[model samples]
Structures are given as structure tokens and as C-alpha cells.
Target chain A: MANERMLMKGNEALAEAAVRAGCKCYFGYPITPQTEIAAYMSKRMPKCGGVFLQAESEIAAINMVYGAAATGVRAMTSSSSPGISLKSEGISYAAGCDLPCVVVNVQRGGPGLGGIQPAQSDYYLATKAGGHGDFYIPVYAPCSVQEMADYAVKAFDMADKFRTPVMILSDGLLGQMMEPVVFPEITDNEPEKDWACTGHGNKRRHNIINSLYLKPEELEESNRERFKKYEIEKAELPEVETYLTEDAEIVVTGYGASARIVRSAVNAARAEGIKAGMIRPITLWPFPEKAYAETVETAKAYLVVELSMGQMVDDVRLATSCKRPVRFFGRTGGVIHTPAEILAQIKLIAKEELK
Target chain B: MKRITVIAGHYGSGKSTFAANYAIDMAARGEAVTVVDMDTVNPYYRTADLGDIFEKNGVKLAAPRYAGTNLDVPILDFDIPGLYAEGRNLVIDLGGDDAGAYPLGKFRQFIGLHKNECDILYVVNFCRFLTHNAEEAEEILREIERACGLSATGIVNNSNLGFETDSEIIGSGRLKAEKISALTGLPIFCHTLPDIPSCEGIDREGYYPLTVYIKNVWN
Candidate 1:
């Protein structure tokens, strides 16, 4: 059947898609760039027969998500940069407890409450260490409205399938922008919640959801089990979109909104007889390492672009194992780089490296 | 035809989105269109963000001087007044709330000089706060009108729930639009749908099919 098309902002699309994905509860606090998600959920959750609560703080909101997810219901919480910092402890706890939940970090400029503008500076925070732990949550960085809607549903499923938290890492640009989106039909076969904490019904044993493990050996075992799931995810869930990568000499790579700019820059470079391509990471944590490895076969040099000060460049370097000269271009503290700026950079890179 | 249109509403009411689409539509119709971004209140979601989209469609943009720059200050371009000349269609995307509408007071003289050819449209989204009902919507409308020193000529019902909007919600918004019209004595200029002729309960004349331009990378 044909999907339904609608015009929606990124935050609102994420919220609505979560509800349609059979998400039963939403817990979020108000923060700029992402406040629309909570506001959208306020009006939509009630109508969908779901729970929507504005918690006292971002800490409370993510903890509420923990509580809801412990019960095996599709639960989520959204926040911006500083707010996500507040949610880190609970995110770590949810990760520790092996509870499934979706966390949306519609990132803003920040090392502090920097600004209410878009930035991808949260790359390390999301990929390396979102909280005080060694656990990694699969992060989906969408570059369009359609992906935002599609990833919301996919994030929930990935969370449940692995019994771990999954993040939809977006920025202010994606959160506030409006676009036409076609939503897929709601899935009919929701996975059964056999391990839910539903009062320990007569047929099943009591399920204890806790993160604490005084025993190092038990914690080590738990960590090992989680890593096994991560290994599976690495093989199965690394997503990237390659644009004009075939027989190209310069490859530009980025994620989220920066990737969108890179696409335009690559196209403009191609129009001017420069063989430019792009590798857009759809999943930031898994990092799409193989895609970079494959691109390196034809591409001579790579330019890593972002809205932050070269955070994802490290990942790209590692993905290619520093086989080629991987350079970086970005702006921090809420500054957005235009396509013209990126195109100029690409032209310069081609002249310098293609020699 | 010469026209000066102002789109104003509360934050999250989709006024910027509507203005962007309206400008694109007019430009596609072969009119010499210029869109002014008077939205200093919202630094992120504004017509300024879609300068490339407007330029690609042959629509001229008159945004803040510091637009697309790092600074978040409101610095209107000197050429804004030139956009109001005869025989060109101009769209002014006003900021949300009364504070956002205050910028329009600067253009009061220009609007008054061309009052017969000008229209200030109060875009309403029934799903947004402070405009969920007729009473609340009218209150905000009065505040915007008082700030701009011009009354709303008509109401554009751009009610939506993002991706969840349907015919039932669109049909329900018509009642709220009628109520808003009743309270303010304004005609329902049009109802906006994401796709035209495909959605039920919307007829041809009073409905506009919109192509949403100002969108982020995600939906």
C-alpha cells in the first residue's frame, strides 16, 4: 500500500513516528531545539492512548524512561545538549540494566549551555561515552525528514531487539526544519515482551531490573554479553549512504546536517569536472567502517565535515586506518557551514591532493 | 498583480513554513517574488535558512543583514523597502508571538502607503498552544495586530500534527478556522494540506497543496 505523505518538522516527525511505532510512553523535559518533540507528544500521545509526561528535569525524564522501559514498553525521552548531559547517568543506568529505550538527543551548540543553534559536537558524547560506562548505544544520524521518521521506528526496534538503549542523534537543524515525509504503515507484528516486569505473573519468574553489580565477575559477564550483541550490530546495522563514490578521487564524509551540505558540495564539484563523492553515515556509533574502507579503494583523499570541531574525523581516520590523507573541515559554537563554503573547500582539496 | 503579504502567528504555528511555500508557489507561477524574513525571534527555523531554496526557484530574499552569519542579532537589510514596489509580489514572514510581530511596526508606514494592495494573514495552527481554541487564537491575533499596527485581512488555517495529520484533523480544523473567523470577522483565506486533491474533505478552491521547503535533514 502507498504510504501517507505529510509536511512535518523533524522533532514532530520523530514524536509522531514513535507513537505510530507503538511507543507506549514519552518522557521529556523542555529544551530549545528539541522542545517541539515534547510539545508534539503532549497533543499526540493522549490521542494515541499513550502516556506523555513533562518531568521536573532531564534527569527525571530519562529515569522515567528507565522505569517505563523496564516494563518492556516502547519508551523514549528527548533533550538537547546540556539536558542530555543531565540524562547521561540514567542512560548509563538503562544501558547497565539491559532495558530497551530510545533516547533522542536533538543536539545544540555546547560544551556548556553554549547556544540554541545546531551542532554535532555531541559525537564523542554519543559514540564514545554518552555516560559513565563502556557501553555503546547504536546511534542513527538522519540527514533528511524521511530518515528521521524512518529511524524513529527503527531505533525502537533496534533497542528492543538488543535489549539496550538506541539513540536518534539529531541536531537543531533537523529538529526545527520542515519537510514532506511519507510514513510507512504501522507494523502489525510487535515483538512479544516476554521479559517484562509485569508483576511476575503465575507462569513466569520474577524479573529484576537493576544496574548495580557489586560482583566484578558478574558485571564482567554482563559486559561480555552486551558486547556480543554489539558485535552482531556491527555486522548487521552499520548504515551509510554513498553518493557518486564510484571512481571518485576526493571523498567527503559527514553525518547529520553536515552530510546534507557535503552532498551539495560534492554535486557542485562534480559539475565543475572535479570527481567528488560523499559517504554519509546513517549510523554514527557503528560508524560504517566498511563503507569507508570500500571508498578508500578508489578515493585518494577524504575530507571529514561536521558541525563540531572535528570529532567524527577520528572515526573516519580509524575506519580507513589512516591509509589515505583524511582532512577535516567544520565550525563549532553554533556556526553552520554553507554549501558554497564546502564546495570551495572541496575545490581546494582537489587542487592540492589530486596533484 | 502587486501584493504585499505578511504571515504572522504564534511560535510553532507553521507561519515560516507557509510563507516559504507561498513564495515558492508564486515564483513558480512566473511572478517576480521577493520574500522578506522578519523573524528575529526564531533564530533557527526561518525563511533565511532556505535562501538556496528560494534562490533556486527565482525568488529574491530580503532577510536580516546578519542572516546566515554567526551573529543572532536582527539587522534588517536596507533594500527591504524597495521590495514593496509596484507589480511585484512580496511575502513577509513575520516572527512568532507579539514580540516577533514588533518588527512589522517598522514597516507600518510602507504597509499603510500600500494598504489597498497589502494583506496581513494570521496563520493559525489549531494544534499549537496559545491558539488551540478560538478565544486563545483571537487573543494572540489581537496582540500581533496591535504590535504590527495592522489588522489581519484573513486567516490561513495551517492546522497540522506534523506527520500524523489526516482528513479528520484537517476537517476538524475547519471548525476552529470558522470560529476564528467569527471572532475576528476575517475570511478563511485557505486551508493548507501537505498534498492536494489526494486528501479527503478538502475541495479545490479554498484549499492549497503545499510543498514544504524549510526542512532539516531529518523529517
Candidate 2:
């Protein structure tokens, strides 16, 4: 079916996609570069017979998502860096209770409330451990505004399919850039939430949603069960986009905005007759280990470019099993690296290592 | 007699893109153009980002104090009144909708002083919601006029779906713009279309071929 394309900002497109993906409830607090998501939802949700709540805090927003998702409703909450930090506790709680919800972290520069520019500094916070527990949420890193819209639907589906919290890990660049997007046709194939804590009406046993299991053995059982699901996810998910990686000497790797810049740099290097390739992780959590390993046979070295201080570089090293030398190039505190800067790094790598 | 154009519209309605293009065009035509970024609501994708292009084209850019500084401070720091007194052709890029237009009241006195010389242009994109129809468009324009204490003298039909814009989209946008023009008794200032081959069948009256300066990464 031909869908009418429209020019939309990244945040607006993501919000509209979530609504079309059967997201009935949206809870968010306004933050820079991502407030358009809440603004779009406020105008859209009510008109579509849904709920849009501007919660008092990020904590309240994610907890509202948790509560709403417990009723078998597709619920979502979005925030930037510091706000996402505030939401970590609630996210962990939802994960502990095995609830399916979508959390969008349109990240900004951060260790604290850093700056309001695009940054992928939260790779660890998102892919490694969002909160204190040993839980992993499937993280999607979209490089384009169209991908931003596409992943919103996929994030919700993955959350429901796995019965676990899922995250769309975007940065300020993807959250703010305007581009043309056509939404996917939504099929109403919602998974049956038989474990939802809706009132049983005496026809079935009342289901209770709780994260606190006082018994250590029960907690261990829950943790072990979640890890088993992670293993299945690692096999079924882990999407990666490879560009000209066959018989290339240098493989540049990054995700989100960095990947977009790296793609351009790879093209520039190719134009100069350098065997430069790229591997972009669409799914950041499973880390696309197999894709990286596949390129290891042909790749001489790896260049990991990011907007942070070498967070994803470690993953690339581990994915390749440290066979190839993985070097990182990055800029922090809200500064974006240009394609020329990345191209310079690639040229240097070719001159030093490729020789 | 300086021509002061203030571009106001709904959010994501191509205000910054139009303002940048207009300023660049005026400067290229040997007008002393000064483009002021009065957008305080949105932090990204403002006219200020085109400062380099403006500089190269001999257009003065009056960006906010906090722009490109990595500071998360929302401060209105443009000297619109001072820029107005320079007698240069002034093109002000406002924020989106009523909330974004509220900051325009800071230079309400300059707009009031040069009421005859000032041309407040309401950029309309039928592709956007809330202002998708004539009635809704008029409602938003009224809200913007109230918020800025300045009435729009002309309407710019800048309806586009980014890269997917075609003649059909342009025709639909024109129909909506005509309705808005009829409802508000405002003249159609111009229709903004990209310099694409598909725009051949569209009406050429008051047609301004737009050079899309604001772009995403992949474009």
C-alpha cells in the first residue's frame, strides 16, 4: 500500500509511529531535543482515544508506563540523559516484574546533566546495565529519522514479543533532525497478555505484578530465567548493517548518529582508493557479534567512532575477539564529529596499519 | 524604507528554511539583509545553524547568545530593535505556533513603529497537523498575531513533505493556501516549491523555487 510521506522531525515521527503501533498511553517529561515527542503525543493521543500524561518527573513518567503496561496496554515514556538516569530505578522495577514497555532515551551529552547536543555516551547505560540489576533490555540504535519512526514500532513489538522492556536508543541529532518518513502499516497482532494484572472478574486467578521477591532463590530463579530469554534474544535479534566489508582492510564501526557520519567517511575513503568499510549495529545490546566476527577474516583493523569517549569500542574489540586492533575516535560534551574528522582517522589508520 | 519580514508559522512548518532562503535571496539581490533568529522554543535546526552560509552570502546573522555554545540555557538575546534601526532588510525567523511566537513581543515596539514597512508573513504547510485546514490555519494565525502583537500581511504557501514533495503535493498545498487566503482576506504572497522536475505542472504565479538549506544527514 502506498502511504503518503510527510516531512517530520525525528521526535514527532517516533511519537506518531508509537501511536500507530497501538501505543495507547504516553507518559513523558519535557526535555531538550526530545520534547517534541511529548508535544506530538499530547496533541495526538487524546484525539485517538488514548492517554498522554505530562508526569511531574521522569520517575513518575516511567512508573506510569509500568503501571499502564501491567494492564496489557502498550505504554511508553521518553527522556534525555539526566532524565533517563532518574528513570532507571522505575525501569529496573518494570524489568524485575517482567513487564513489556518501551523506553526511548534520546540521549544528550552526559555523566551528569551535561549538554543538550547529540551524544552516544549512554551506550553502557542502555546496552550494558540500565539499572542496578543484571537485566538487559534490547536496545535499538537508529541512524536516520526514518529509522527513528521504523524502530518505534519495532521496539514495541520486541517488548511484547519478549515480554521485557525494550529501548530505542537515539541521540539529540536523530531526535531533532527533520526528514521525510512514511509510517509502516500497523497490523493489530498484539500478543495475548495473559499474565496482565487486570481484575480477574472471578473467571480466573488474580495476577499480581511485583518486583520484590524476598527469597534469594526465587530472585535467582527470576534472574536466571531472564538470562535464558537474553540468550534467545541474542540469537534471534542482533541486527547489523555492513557496507563494503568484503575484502576490506579497515572496518569503521559506530551506531546512531556516529554511524551516519562514519558511512560518509567510508565513502570518502573508498573514493580515495582505500579499502574502507563500515559495520553499523542496528541492535546495540546483542551487539551484533556474529556480524563483526564475519568481517574479521577480511578486515585488517577496526576504527570505532563515537560521540562519547570510546564506549562502543570495547564491544567491537570483544566482538572481534581482539584479533584486529580496534582504535576509537570520539568527541564529547555535545560536540559532533564531522565526516572529515572521521575520514582523517581512517586515512591515518590506512597509512599506519594497512601498510 | 527598510523591508522587515517576520516569518511565523506552526511548528515544523518550514519557517526557518523559508526565512533562510528569503534572506539569502534578498542579500544576493544586493539588499543589506540581516536575518535574526528569534526562535527560543526549539533548541535545534534553527536559522542560526546556517550562519556560515549567511556570512558567505553577505547576510548578517543575529543569533541568540546561547546558540552553538553547548549551553542548555533558553535566553532571548537578539537585539531586534537595534538591528531594525540599522535600516537593513530584516528577516526574523520566529519560533513555532503561539508559544514560540510569544518571544516576538520582545520587539513589539519595533514592529509597531514600522507597521507600514514590516511584512509579517505566516508560512503555512498543509502537510502539518493543527493547521492542516483553512479554519485551523486561520485559528493558528490569529493565535500567533495575538501572541506577537503583530498581524500578518501576507501568506506564504510552503507546504511540502520534505524530499517526497511532488506536483500533487504542491497542488494540494495550494488548494489549502487558497482557502486560507479566502478565509482571512490575506493575499497569497508566494508558493514555495523545490527546484524539482515534478514541480513543472504546478501553477507558476508567485512561485518561488526553494533551495532546501535545512537537511537531514542522509539527504
Candidate 3:
């Protein structure tokens, strides 16, 4: 089927993909930057004969997702920053039960009820396990509208493949931007229904899906097994795109919308005498470490720029392992740094590195 | 000091009626009391609304203006205008149970931040959910505390059989109160009646569920 072309907003693509990927249930609150996802689902999902519940709150929305996902059907919920914060407990529980589900965090400014603008401020909260335990979710950071449309299928697959909570770590820009996208043709991926909580029936006994493990040894075994799966994920799931890295002396790196901006910055920098390349990590949690393995060889120093105050810098620093100094340029609270501003930083980095 | 008391319980447990009486009593005592109608589940129980007597007394009623409008957003918005610091009470009349209590989660972190002035009273009906048994009551209490981020919760046995509530049922409620007190270690602050001034209250009011009556002709 010659890929159908359509002008699509990022949020609309996500909702459409969720349907095409066999996601039948959706629970969400209407929030800015991501309302189109819910609105699109509300109209299309009902027509598709799926369940669309505009929950009492984000907590209720996530809990409803938890309930539906526990039954092992494709269930999802979407929200922005503060709303994502409220869903932390349910997300952690999903992780604990090893349930395959997707959480779309269309991030805005945060720490509190922040502004409804694009921001990658949730880099830490999304990557580092929050909410009260040692559980991790494979976080995917998509840069373009194509990935936004694409990952609704990919996230559920990755989540099922790992039996982990998979995140499409997007910001307001990716959530709102309209672009050309080729939606995946609806076909059966045929997910395994063995572990799902869709009623045990007479198959054997009750299949209890819970996070609580009362015995210490029992909990210890689970924690160990979860990490083992994470290790396998760490080895396999690294993604990035490198532009002009052949003889580049300085690397400009970011993810989500910041990567799109930094890509523009790199194009501008190459026009100048500075050989700057942009490395965009599409998968954030099982971070694209392989791309950064030879950081000292290709680039003298890596500049990690983002909308939040040096959030992704921590990951880049660990990936580089201090072999080369990783400089950070960031602004907090929903402020977007222009390509011109980032190019200026690249110029400064070229001056210091080439010297 | 003015107290910001949060009255919370499960669905159909008379939380709003109890809250209304408490606010009215405080108002009648010549004290400035603000009653926020934070019941998101049922809008009809809201006593202090747009033009109600409670609103007439600057009661500051904050209930969801309509249904299905952002359920997670607290039904009643909170506005503490130097009235409370001046020794006036701020009583937030909350909705029932975990589903009802969810909108309050956003305020929970703030409650932890304050931790001093705000007090949450888990309004228990010896009638609803796990409150009928000691173990069930303890589990419900634990669930409420965990969900609400509340370390301390006082109880109010609003265990009346609606308009027909009587003394014997109240006695059974007292038995529940004793068991709950032992289980959760929280004291029963008060019990409620259905404004029954003289006649014995009914035993089967609970059997009468609140049903919506739609006006119609034969179709």
C-alpha cells in the first residue's frame, strides 16, 4: 500500500496510530499541547467501536488505563507535565507488574502547574525512576511528527517486547506541530495474551496483576528480574541520527523539539567554518549510548542544550563518561531557545575547541 | 486559630449533608465560616450553591459548576482571603471515597507543604464500603490515607438511614465506631442524623437509592 500522504498534527497522528495499532481503550484529561490526541480519539475511537473515557481526573485517567491495561488489551492515556506528575503512582505500578503499556508525556514547564508551552524539563523525571521504587521505563524521545505518529505502534510493541512501561517522551511542540506523516497500515502484530490480565477463565486459575510483593525474597527476585530485562534493553535500544560527524570537532545534541532546533543550528554552523553535527536521540531512557561511544574521537566536546535547566546533560555526561567535557545550555520554565541562540553557542564551542 | 477542616467519605455516605450542618452551625454561632462544596460526584447535594442561603452568608461555596467538566479539577476552588488567619473557619465539604477524593490529590502535596494549618477528616459512614466490618474499615482507612497523603484522619460516623434514621441503627453504628477506633486508632469526632428532631428514624432508608426521575409521557 503505497504510503498514504496526509497533513497531520503530531497529536492527531498519535491518536490515529493508537487506533491503527489495535488500541481500543483511552482515558485522558483535556490539557493543552495534547488535547488534539484526546479530541481525535473521542471522535474516531467511538466510531472504531473502542472505549474512550474522559476520566474524572488525570489520576482517574491513569488508574483507568491501569485497570484496562491489567486486562492485557492495548490501553493508553496522554497528558502534559503536571498531569503526568499525578499519574506517577499508576505508572510505577504498571512498571512493577511488568505490564506492557504506553504513557505519552507531552511535557510543558513544570515543578508545579507550569505554563502550557513546550519544554523538555521532564528529562530527569521521565528517565530516573520516580514515585517510590527502583523501577524503570524505556523512555522514547521523538524529534519529528513522523516519530510522534509512528511511536504509538512502536511504543506498545517495545512495551510488550520488554513487558515494561514505554514512554513517548514528547514536548508541546511535537504534540502540537502539523506535518506530513505516513500512517502505518493496520495489520495484526498479534501480541501474546498469555501474561495479560484478561480474566484467567477456566484456563487455569486467577491471573492476579499486582505490584505488591509481600515477602522480601519474592520482591527481591522481581527487582532482580526487572533489572535483567532492562540490561537487555540497554544493550539493544539505542537510537540517534548523526549529521556531518565525519570530521566534526564539536557535537551539538538534544532530543524531542530541542533536537529539531539543534538540527537547524547544525545546518547553520556547517555553513560557517565550524564543522558541527547534531546527534538526536530518539530513544531517551535506554539512551543512545552507542552513538556517544566514540565521543572523544569524532568531537572535541559535546554541547547538551535543552529547554530545561541541564536535564538531559546528566545522561550525555554519563554516556561520554567524562572522557570529554560536556557543556550545557538551557532555559527553564517553558522558554524555547532559538536556532540562532544555539548557533551562537556552537560558535563559542568551536572557538574554544579548535584553539 | 481558624481550622480548615476537610470532610471526606465514600459515595452516598451523607458527606455533603454533614458538611452543610457543620458550616451552618458555625455560621449560626456568629462566626465567619466558608463552606466549599468540593463534592464532584453528586452536584445535587451541594447545599451552598449560587443563590442558596449559605452563599448568602459569604459561605464561598466551590462545587463543580457542571458535570463532566474536568473531573480531576477540584469541584470547588479554594480561596482563603485573610479570613481564616483572622480566626474564621475554612471547612471544605469534600465528595466521597477514592474516586471522589482524587481531585484533591493536586492539593495533597500542598497540604504536606503546609502540614500545620490544614486538617483532613475522613468522614466514615458505618454503612458504606469496608466500614461495615473492622478489617474492611482498616483497609479503607489505609487506602484513603495513602491516596490523600494524609498521615492523620479523624472520623465522623454519619451513619444515618437517610430521613427515616433511628436510634437502634445509630447503636450499630456506635459498635462500628468502637471497632474502627481500635483498628485505625482514630477517634469518632461526631455522628449524623437526618435532621430528625422527634420521631424515631427509619432503618431501611439505605434501601432507597437516590434515583433520577425523568419527566415523560407515554412513548
lDDT of 3 by residue, A170-227 (tens): 9877776545567876667747778776766687777888888899999999999989
Q: What are the TM values for chain B, all candidates?
A: 0.91, 0.93, 0.74
Clashing pairs in 2: none
TM-score of every candidate's chain A:
0.98, 0.98, 0.97
Count backbone overlaps in model 3: 9
Candidate 1 lDDT, tens digit per residue, A162-249? Answer: 8889999999888887666777677754578877787965777888898888899989998998899899989989999998998889
Q: Please, what are the lDDT tens digits per residue for candidate 1 over residues B15-93?
A: 8788988989888898988888988776776688888888899988888877755465766665446766545788989
Task: List the RMSD of every prediction in angstroms.
Answer: 7.8, 2.6, 20.4
Stretches of candidate 3 exceeding 4 Å from the true structure: B1-219
Instruction: Give Cα distance to truth, residue B21, candidate 1, Å.
Output: 12
TM-score of candidate 1 versus the correct structure, residues matched by position: 0.74
DockQ of 1: 0.12
Worst 10 residues of 1 chain B by lDDT: B210-219
Ranking by DockQ: 2, 1, 3
| C-alpha lDDT of candidate 2 relative to the true structure | 0.89
